[model samples]
Target: MRSPSIAAAASTAVLMTLASASRGQTTGGFSLDRFEPAPAGDAFFGVPSPAAPGHLAPRVHAMLDYAHRPIHSSGDSPIDLVSSQALLRLGASLALWDRLLLSLDAPLAVAQGGDDPGIPGVAFTELTAPELGDLRFGARLRVLGRDAGPLQLGIGGYLFAPTGTPAQYTGDEEPRGAFHASLGGRLGTARSSLGFLWSASGGVELGGGPNRPQQLTFGAAAGALLGGDLLQLGAEAYGAAPLGGDLLLSSTPVQREEAGLNAELLLGAKLRVLGGLTFGAAVGPGLTNAIGTPSVRAVGMIGWAPLPQPDSAERAPAVAAGDKDDDGIDDALDACPDVKGDPSPDPAMDGCPPADRDGDTVRDIDDACPTTPGARSADVTRSGCPDDRDGDGFHDGIDACLDVPGSSSDDPRKVGCPADADDDGIVDASDACPKVKGTASRDPKQNGCPDDPDGDGVRGAADACPNERGRPDPDPAQNGCPRFVRVHADEITTSKPVQFIVYGKTRAQTVAPISDDLLREVRDAIQQNPDIELVEVQGHTDDSGSEEYNLRLSQERAEAVLSWLVAAGVPREKLVARGYGFERPLGDNRVKTGRQKNRRVQFMIIKRKGAAVQR
Candidate 1:
């Protein structure tokens, strides 16, 4: 259902004219094309807004559209019962004082087609099909609102002359008039900023006859411009309901509903280009299968007007200004063209000044800190001027985010805001790892950083002992971990042996007479592990002692150790004293080293709070 041949439509029209002559009176309905070109200043597609686009001058426009199968049938006899034609609409309008607008529009069918010689739709058009449509004389007046807003109103009227061929489905058989009012609104100037335009029109078509029906026409359109002002997208819906007997079934072979009622919704896209030129296209479904309503329709439009160019004020050929010395002054005016200089009031010194190579205000000849920028100071060694500490162009006095260097910005509030390369919201100024995306933290060194894997609270690249969990320490080697103490599953082990005093004839030993830091570590280990319900203090003696005396001496030494631990904050109930003289030794007692090892004390974990502790 696209274009139908002209020969088919022309032959159909001829047959229709002969059939109409036989019937005599104007047949029932199904004639005129329902589509109309929207006038200039249209807010969205076809809906007219209150604004007068050409209020200061006359504006002329032309629009072309191809309507597909405007009059079609679901019955397979003829896919398209009426013509699918192309219309070229030409219109001109003049708005007076921004309120009144008068327009003239002429529409012609450049190409058209309909059903073959004998379709039911052809009989309904009781006249010869013509290539022209009704000529429109239109006028409108804005009755309310001075500017485009939510509640602006415009009232208008249209007079259509009988310049069309009903047989061709382009217009009515007689003159018609319509009165309409439109309500509209326009917000913002750009679609990206949520700018939009909308309007709706309601009107009555008057004066009806057998071939033409009085009608109620209503429509609304909404649109927005995107891509700056280059693209516009919009949708429009308009429908007309035939009044009086037009809705009644006529005595015809057309299957009763011969009257035409127009209702179609269209979606359109428009492109604005080349200053004042606009090109657009649209397509949508016909809501109902009325006589002139199609199953679907498509439209394209283009408009143009004179471009309002900006008034030229300073239009001269682009020529680079001469500045040989690369200073602020031109070569013609520079006293020393080859050298850069500061501006001076005296002509002889215009481009020459004591060279401040670093561009500091202080002249190089009197500059105390020539390489380092410093302001003039009372002291001779340093000028009175301020110094640039961070060297971020701005002196420390004005470097707002002073911790990190930043670039200057056109925005006054963010004069030297730093960049956030990772886009993590933390600027490089305070971000410890600025190049990588991370979260913020309380630690300044770890701010905008990744997780601390060792659970030591140390983060980023600053952690020296990253693989091993340790506390923060000034000495990198120790890393806050002790050198000697290690808690094992069954006991506390130390790199150094515990020291004690040995006295008496039986070789009795007491911890009170000697002290070692490893002893304190053992006490701390037992205290730290509250789950160890009981720890046995074992004392052993070398083979040199007589069995009975050695056992007694060992028991005495074990008991003494328990008493010493209880005094050092180990619970008395958590300790059990026992002696096994020489029963278990780390080395044989035959050698001197073995004898010393055999006389040493060892603690054993006997019972834990819940389960046996695992190493």
Candidate 2:
């Protein structure tokens, strides 16, 4: 049978270990404070060292600990003592604001056992009962760094209440208070794969209970992050030395007296299983002879914070699915879903600009002259404004003298004070001989007169054929005439192709109808230029469908156009039709707009000897 004093003392040691662990001190038991094993994963089963990181959210942690001591001594006995203890602790902490944290911990002594010698101060024989432990509440305020820094500092105070059966060594059976300051920091680089942390704390307890002597306690811990912060291996050394008080045999001896030191080698792992839930485990063995230090200790824990979950039920059912723009894209995925537009890679421009109805680069909301077409520019005064090359109020589109500044006017044809190059009263646009001054006449055609280049007797402005000399006729239209006709190559070839509207059962093989306006132009050109021998009408199409089919279609279309021209008035001998098909695409066929421009008919003027060719 063990002495009551010895049993009490050993049990007290077990209780002390449990208390230290719950308080996040390294003395014994499992510290339930906040220690981050990884940057994102915190220690779940052990009290965080003073150097641990601070959190922004509230967290609850629960841990189960099992400790076994193969050998221990209480100074009263020369024989070695053996014991086992189990503790269940529940702790919660919340960061009230900034770096301030409030925490509470409660533990239950599930089981305890050992060889008892019935020492004088022992309170119980063999362990056979389970009971509640003391309750500890604390507030920690970080004075220095909270989340990240080379060094972190904090000050904290805790209150302990007698809530357990003292006979079972669960508590001191009295109220006690303690104040402490902690300084900790990280060594090596957190940015590096491997790093280390060092923490130390010291404080004094104040109370009058037999177990609550006014003593000083201090602890230090060092740990290293391994395997990319997945594992933490460290060591801790801590103890309490009585300063001045009546000798409290049970409580004080369990934590060591005067200047005794306890050491432990620890290993732990933490895993972030969910958004804000973490699970961890730690196991270690004591390396020094200390009253409360256990030979081997193991702990398992689970921690959770509610605020990190975004997909929780609380947030569901509040979002709606709809498309406001009717652009085939949903509002949830569209950047500018309110306005209809095609898909674009840029999020800001994912939809069409609402105010730019005409698809102009300038937005109508900022465009001063919204109705008119203009260029986009970075110049503050000119941006979104109509092009006024000469800084004149009138836009170039309406200004007759585009290169010179002039006053604005209501006349549509006389914008920018239409220039008279020859100093003629009439503007260049109205003057037939703009470079030479002329006299006005009653005839509208002769209003702006000029010298007759052909010496046709009639003025150049009134002569129908100013370049050719002819006998003056009574009728103004036939005053000047040319005996033979001539035409320039440039007059036949135009920038815009002759468009044909095709209609048939098959789009590719359809016979296209030539425009009457185009036919008239071709006929007039041939008639005026009697010297022109041949005119080749070439047809081309975009790359689509069968190449052979496109070639045949192109040839047929070219022939159709030439036939229409011939029927309109052009002689067959002067016309030749050919097809280049999809091989002569003028633009990219992959896009809709490019393909539209690629389908066209081209006119090439072939002149005989002595006739000038523009090319």
Best by TM-score: 1
Poorly placed runs, candidate 2 (over 4 Å): 1-56, 74-82, 118-124, 185-198, 222-236, 244-259, 305-615
Each model's lDDT: 0.64, 0.59
- Write the residue-wise lDDT of candidate 1 on 243-266 in tens digits: 744421133332233344578888
User: Can you tell me which runs of candidate 1 are displaced by over 4 Å?
Assistant: 1-18, 22-31, 76-79, 117-130, 190-193, 247-261, 305-615
Model 2 reaches what TM-score against the true structure? Answer: 0.41
Top candidate by lDDT:
1
TM-score of each: 0.46, 0.41
Name every residue pair that clashes in candidate 1: 375-384, 375-385, 375-386, 376-383, 376-384, 376-385, 377-383, 377-384, 377-385
lDDT of 2 by residue, 1-615 (tens): 123454445443433232222232222221211121211123323323343333566678777777676335555453333476677778877765557777787878787766554445434334444778777887777778744444888888788787765444556656778778877766544333455767777877776355445767666777776533444566655545557543233332344332133445556665544455767777778665544457787777777753222222224233347779876555765677776665565766665544675456787655545566677777655556667788677777677878877665565665776556556697766776554567776666666765686565766676655544445677755555432222344435443455544334443224344355545655665765567778888888988779999899788888877877777778899889998889977765644566778888777776654775567
